[model samples]
Target: MRTIQLKKILNEHCIQFIEKKQMDLSLSIEDANSSLHSASNSTAGDKHDTSRAMMHLEIEKKSKQLNEVVQLKKLIPILIDNSQQKSFGVGTVVETNAGSFYMSFNAGKKEIEGQSFTFISLASPLAQAFKNNLNKKEFQFMQKTYTILKTF
Candidate 1:
């Protein structure tokens, strides 16, 4: 598949994943807040206090996750620039002996048009190795050498 097409697919998948995660986190936060409010009005002393505290913790956790999702959403477009480059960089789709990779985000395995591609962040170990050895025909990571089949 073409790099632009692959990038588009990965972008859509990443956005969908982050949005879905945000929705779930929002729901959890709402539920936790509701429980906390209810607990505040309860007559049960110790149990009510404990329940409210736990709900507060839960809200904090879910709020943190929601913040992360929002950050990820902001990061999506920065990596999708379709600049032309001979070597690997952000927005490039790489095919190697090891596997196909989209140097965009850590969205894991994505299958497009019958081909499997791993969506990885540019800061990933493998991508860092590739960065250091730009234009090299092959490179080794963890004792395994991967031939640079193509990059676009």
Candidate 2:
């Protein structure tokens, strides 16, 4: 697989995940707000208590998921859309003799064209190995050495 192709795949995956996260957050927020409204309007008794408890849980869960979605949104800008130039940073697709790897800086593994490539975060250990290196440099991962064939 080529670096450009791998990059396209990673970009698609990131977009899909972001969309799903956003949708989930929106739905959760709506549900939580509705639950709160219903709890407030309840006549009193077990129904009110149950609604209150459910609302609290929904709010907590939604808040956590919203935070995660925000973080993921921040990473969207890191992905390089221009394929003209290549760099040794997150969002850059790296090609090695062994296989292609997409450095998402946010997303996880994504398979492309029958090749199981690891879409690693920039903070990951393997990414650190090639952090500041340029194209044609050799990076060692675990016990294996991979030569940087190309970047895009």
Candidate 3:
């Protein structure tokens, strides 16, 4: 596992968490505004209905964002230290003949240092493929092949 790749993975996770938080905040503000509008126009049933609809949409958006926040919280602990990661733990970078990749507890893909890398959560299919593989070994996915060259 390359240190640079691990750092990149952690940095990316941090950015994603920040973005999700921003989205959550924005949705909260929108929801509040919808409620206020609905209150102000209570005399008009149609306007109140429209505001209610908008509020529903905002609630859905906030719910999704909250779910994302929960996922991000699970990832935050792992991202805190890219270095000194436990063996076979999430956020531990793995070096392969194909390239350097980060093993995340959250599934995703990323590129680092001009190299394309796959980010797989601990429970992901690809992570399971490589898990418990102590020695250098070959891993095949969708006809593409990669070898676990080393572990840092």
Over 67-108, each residue of candidate 3 has an lDDT whose tens digit, in order, gives 766666666655656446657766666778777666665435
What lDDT score is found at residue 23 in candidate 1? 95
Choose 2 or 3, whichever is better by TM-score: 2
Ranking by lDDT: 1, 2, 3
The window of 10 residues in a row where model 2 has the poorest summed lDDT is 78-87
**How close to the true structure is residue 74 of candidate 1, measured as C-alpha lDDT?**
86
User: How well does candidate 1 score on lDDT at residue 58?
Assistant: 87
- The TM-scores, one per candidate, come to 0.83, 0.65, 0.63
Runs in model 3 deviating more than 4 A are 1-9, 12-51, 54-58, 105-110, 132-136
Top TM-score model: 1
What is the lDDT of every predicted structure here?
Answer: 0.79, 0.72, 0.66
> Per-residue CA lDDT of candidate 1, range 1-152, in tens?
66566677777877787788889999989988988888888897887888888888889999998998898888767665543444567777778888888777787787888878888888999888877766786888889998878777
State each model's C-alpha RMSD to the native: 2.2, 4.0, 4.1
